[model samples]
Target chain A: MTAIQISVFLENKSGRLAEVTHALAKGGINIRALSLAETIDYGVLRLIVDKPKEAKTALAEAGFTVTETEVIAVAMPDRPGGLAGIVDLVTRHGLNIEYLYAFVGQRGENAVVIFRVDNAEEAITALQEGGAHVLSAAELSAI
Target chain B: MHETTPCWNREMEFMEEGHLRPLQSERLRDVVARVYERVPYYKEKLDAAGVSPEDIRGIEDIVRLPFTSKDDLRDTYPFGLFAVPMEQVVRVHASSGTTGRPTVVGYTRRDVQMWAEVMARTFAAGGTHIGDVVQNSYGYGLFTGGLGAHYGAELIGASVVPTSGGQTKRQVQILQDFGSTVLCCTPSYALVIGETGREMGVDFAGLPLRVGFFGAEPWSQSMRQEIEASLHVDALDIYGLSEMIGPGVSFECLEKGGLHINEDHFFPEVINPKTGDPVPDGELGELVFTSLTKEALPVLRYRSRDLTRIVTEPCGCGRSLRRMERVTGRTDEMLIVRGVNVFPSQVEEVLMRIEETTPNYLLVLDRKPRGMDEMEVQVEVSERTFSDEMSKLETLSERIGGEIEETLGLRVSVRLVEPRSLERSTGKAKRVMDRRDLGR
Candidate 1:
């Protein structure tokens, strides 16, 4: 609940990513972080951008199918135990992590790790109850 | 337009539409009565629906009868459609349902004769004279296409070279030695023969083949023209359904435009596929057939699922029996990939036009990570016109993709593979490999 993920379908051709980036850039939305999962013909561009709403709307207007999903952003120490502490908390709560990718926060020693877990809402609640600091969308987007 | 003689009576290939009506009427009446008395399946359906054999007066009254589906044949399994006993049944041919279980139909000697007559008429329509030898390449056995064409050639007094599919060298030898005048097989096989003949330096112009009757699967008109040009024969289209009658329902004459349905033997009705309502003339719809005169097995209004527009107007070939345009695709085979409807025949048409591509191709539909369908077309590049350059291959793929998108109204990734790269069966080429949600 502390973070959200958006998926963008892009054809696997030259300059397709550039086209998506230019559309979002012109709409004043910067990419905070992105990862691509590809097949033989096309790829799904998962983005944690500055403004998820504006970026998704811009991409949709550019003829891309975009879907938003809820995820968790756990702020942890940049040291080794920082990420381990959050994973340990989720494992303790009996929740499986479907996918996880992290990005550094804008102005803190703490790094924000994006976690797509089986139960995003329960995982967020349990992590907070376990003394973890979660970053807001605006606080994490400046990363 | 000058009316062609029903050609059904004069040409043994056809039973004239007019001549067939009374025979169909009598057969309908007899089958209903016989089925009511003998077959429990028929009796139960008729009785449950509060219908009686007396209600079926003629062929026109056929619409009132219940529709029989492939399920009906499968539900009964082996010999449910047979009007005769096991001892009376002579031979059997079946639907090649490779994905599931095949449906088998038993044929008595009379059924074979019916097949022979229809096939014979098929050859005669192509102007096959008695002395001509035919290089019959259609597969034999349960496929029905091979023996169906062979018997028809034999019935017309043409010496048949029983070259039952494959063995390219042997097929060519028979073509040259016996002077096979007419070729009968699927359009793809015919192209293979043409390619092999050229490789062996067989004279295309000097070959005895003047006519070729191609059917079994749906082929494009562009491919038909390619086959005609390659083999130097007046190519004709032969239409038949195994369920209704094996390979001689209707045929094309010297007029190579459309196929003339043997309306007398197989009365066709184009119906709205969704609602099952009758469609007006010249409209595209699912083709349904009522076997008016079949004895061993009579199927009433069995849906062929072949998408074609019916043309009742007489052809210039002197056949008044209605003709249908070449089948575009089957309703069952229509694939919805990425919200666009795609048919294998559409891609086939584009490939045939390229002249450098073989008829062999496979359509692979897979789900992308985003849960959307992606299509990949694997086409067999002709070895004769093979290109060595990567750029040429790229250009070929691009051109094919563009044409496919234009024709199918869907974007597809086209891959130009080497000759024989795609899988080929000895009988009936598999042109599509749809892998999108078959589990459901």
Candidate 2:
């Protein structure tokens, strides 16, 4: 249940976020979900786009430093404490969440949360056995 | 009052203007004859210009000679420009040749002695005296700065530290423990030391640094002010090139008005860069020099390409040697962006004034897809100013861009890089990267 995520290295300056988004839009790639981790000097922009390879190429060609990382997307009910339930399941299985962000399904039926963990395979299996719905790469991209 | 002045050679430094002109005229005549007779390159150029040693009767006629450029030196390669035979040459030094083939310079035994004499004069002009401790931090070997200063300090009987750049922490400790009174290095390296000392909790101002001889790169007045205040020392500018005889061509005395050229050894002339005609004193132009007494490498009417004015007014320090204003920029290094001239040093002046940015920066020039020139200035934000807040970072970039536009009269995109992202140099720092052809 692992998915591909595109991360870009960006200097903490004005119009940088817009530059990346504009490039993706011009490339006709849709960013389904995104999160940004930043420090004083630079930021890490993580993106879940429709076409990961194409988005990476477009951003790289536009002079952005980009990287590909594998993450797992967990599906949950679109209700209160939905993310908390997934976190509890991972914690009970002794799996740590490196980082996570959530987005509503395109159909608005369920909430899909993307997570980065130390061991993607173990997290996927544990979450699956814990009654969590883990979406495949195709399913995550479709949503 | 004259007895108290620390002039290495009072005769040359305080020569009367009337005597100075005759001395320069005699040396100029002798050097021109030597080059025309010994070096084929000078001979052919002089012959092609339809001029001979007989035609140059005085220093005034030096304008009639052909100008020698760095490209000429490069074309001749190693030892081609040497007037003396290889067996008579005693020393050799070369330019870094970051762009292409290195230009080599040779020195005879007398040339070495002359170099030592000028460097000693430079040291004394900066108020360094015997029994003082000197820390020579300019890079050693091939590069002329380190060994040039080393010999000069030794000639003056000062105790030399011989710490040849790098090792910032250790350099600070040595500065304090050794009681170094004289510092010699590029000004940027001096700033690096000051910043590193402050980070290490060392009070650089509390140290015994009385004077600094900084050169080998173009710097600004604001940088000098910052360095002087931070190190609590009188920061002086020294000018020279490897093509010339190292770091003793000229130096700032206590008057700090302008750098006094050792005109008795190196003749100075300011010429319009395009027209090749001498510009009147007090006006900006390209600086050209002719080695009056150099034995091995007697360059006749060598174009220095440095932009500055000649100051004939006698210095308050009692030196009659004509001084040249601080070099503003170089013709080769000036970038024409959208028909506006921009010098990296001007950008550096702006960056040094901003408290949030470090002096370390890179200028990238490229051609946009639409055939317009695009200039990007990559500056490293100080560790304290590096913030995750996009608004603060954007404000800093905007402020830098605005300052550059105001100063250089050209709009440039400012890219704020991480601290230490740009490469630091022990020798001359590479500041510009032209990628206009990469678009092709």
Give the least accurate 10-residue stretch of model 1 chain B, judged by summed lDDT: B1-10
- Please name the candidate that would achieve the greatest TM-score relative to the true structure: 2
TM-score of 2: 0.64
lDDT of 2 by residue, B1-440 (tens): 47677789999999988999988899988988999899999999999999999998888998998999998999899889998889999889988899899999999898888898999999998888888999999999999999999999899989999999999899999999999999999999999999998999988767888999999997777778989988889999999976679899999997888899999999999987777889999876789988899999988778898988998677788888899989967867777789887777678769878988888899999897899999999998775545433456678889999999998889999887856668874445788999988535
Tens-digit lDDT string for candidate 1 (B388-438): 233455677788889888887888888655455467634546767777775
Report how far off residue A74 is in candidate 2 (Å).
49
**Where does candidate 2 stray beyond 4 Å?**
A1-143, B1-3, B335-440
Proportion of native contacts in model 2? 0.09
Model 1: lDDT to the true structure:
0.77
Which one is best on lDDT? 2
